[model samples]
Target: MNTSIRRALGTTALTTAALLAASGVASAHVSVNAPSAAQGGYTVLEFRVPTESETASTTAVTVELPGLASARTEPIPGWTATTEKDGGDLVTSVTWTANPGAGVPPGEFQRFVVSAGPLPAQDEVEFPATQTYSDGSVVDWNEATPASGEEPEHPSPTLELAAGSDDTVASAVAAPSSSDSDTTARWLGGIGLVLGALGAALGIGATVRSRRS
Candidate 1:
């Protein structure tokens, strides 16, 4: 009922809100943003990477072509590109690296293009990624294949290659669409806001009554 009690409750509420906001930002790091493999063949795949830090820029992107034996990339100007073979045969698996010119500014994104060879006749292929920031921080986008319904603690953008014809594995990674999932989420959030407002009003009223008594 006292000024001190009101102040403490207000501080606790604000602290909770801040914690939620911070958690949201941390969960929203690097994500895949373009054409997914939709009926795969010799097609160009574009990956978009946006740096998270306002003070740091993105300096490099490394794409690990796991299992796909023959994949190549189109040359990017002002950028250094290289490829390395996986263990076993020299042509079995390859990983490519691209360094951006200068650095990708905060809130800005860069695209990486690579040519995929003929996809496997069946099964899915995941193109995992690792992103490097200008401040010497690296984020690996490779999470467990077939995401477990939970956004991973650390998640990477992945392209799912479905099997059909010889060139059936679609080369397109469709961007996440909010239209299907977030509508109910928004309604629930509105309900939560109303509940929160009601709770605050009750607390204020209780404080007033106690002070009068």
Candidate 2:
């Protein structure tokens, strides 16, 4: 192959590999999914936690929601959830602790669901989380992304909301039956593979045409 065509194929392969690695790293972080509702609306939020330690299980997690009007947690069979209220009787945070031998093991993840709202009127919201490991180590995900465009090692889970709507109904807020962000990540990986394959085919065709000329 010509030098230019060879470089193009090599670059494509490297880019695809980088994207796949990033997807795996992202899944290890504690994240929140907002399926519905915006500012001033009621909705259910899903906190997805993955155990990043190779040898330790996740024992507990606490998510904070300051100034929230209300919150109700769903029960998980082996875990106990406690909701904290502010001085005004509004829910401020919720903590979930696993029962004996029930914590999330390595390479596994769990979703904790909570119904909350009326969210404050804002374009974006953050839900900082504190994760505890079986090894007695704690990690806090609370750093805000700065203007430098570099992501922090333990970035907080943030969600962007649409403009406020009075017609928003609480019944419309539906949490996913399962927490599998892998669906979107898989699509991205497939596209990268297709791009790499196309680049190789084009480079080969160009080389063949030139040889015959």
Candidate 3:
């Protein structure tokens, strides 16, 4: 084999391998594994954060609640947590701070829990999470507000709250419009008859024209 050809092939192979490794690294981050909340009541939510570092070990993590919503975090060993309250009657404020132990090695995962009360009046609620890495990096998981206002991909952790049965499910229901349905059916039927008559007349005109021609 020629020397130049061998060199080019080796370079191509190295580039391909590097691209694959970089793609995997770009996807790695801290994320919530599972979340739970109760309906019409306060619930403690737990988030499992995985910190993966190639060069530096994670020393601490800070999670900020959006809109300063009130929450209390469960304590972990070798870690300190705190909260901030709102002055007005609006949603309260809270935050969770975590510190890794000295014996903790690199690429370690941790868990933090928080308690929040009097959830909003929606059937579902989402908590957009932001994670701060030891290397001064931030990851935000809030994404892609759907058409139905529900995001499936990269969705914020969500809690489903079912409405009470006595809350009159009928009020939530939307009644079908009989007038609109009738109008649609009438338009379709009229269009069909018009098209059929036009087709028949065109066929008869073609037959007469052929006879004359």
Task: Using TM-score, give the best candidate's number.
Answer: 2
Each candidate: what lDDT? 0.63, 0.85, 0.57
Indicate which candidate wins on lDDT: 2
TM-score of every model versus the real structure? 0.54, 0.73, 0.49
lDDT for each residue of candidate 1 in 41-122, tens digit (9 for 90 to 100): 5456677677777888878887766444455766765566667664432223233344545767887877777666554443
lDDT of 2: 0.85
Displacement of the residue 103 alpha carbon in candidate 2, Å? 0.7
Clashes of each: 16, 0, 1
Please, what's the RMSD in Å of model 3? Answer: 23.6
Off by over 4 Å in 3: 1-36, 58-70, 89-93, 100-107, 145-155, 164-213
Residue 198 of model 2, lDDT score: 100
Question: Per-residue lDDT tens digits of candidate 3, residues 1-213?
Answer: 699999999999999999988764543444443244434445676665555555544445445443323466776777777665444322333445545543123566666777765444467766666656556666565674688974344445555665533333332232223454577899999999999999999999999999999
Q: Tell me how candidate 3 scores on lDDT.
A: 0.57
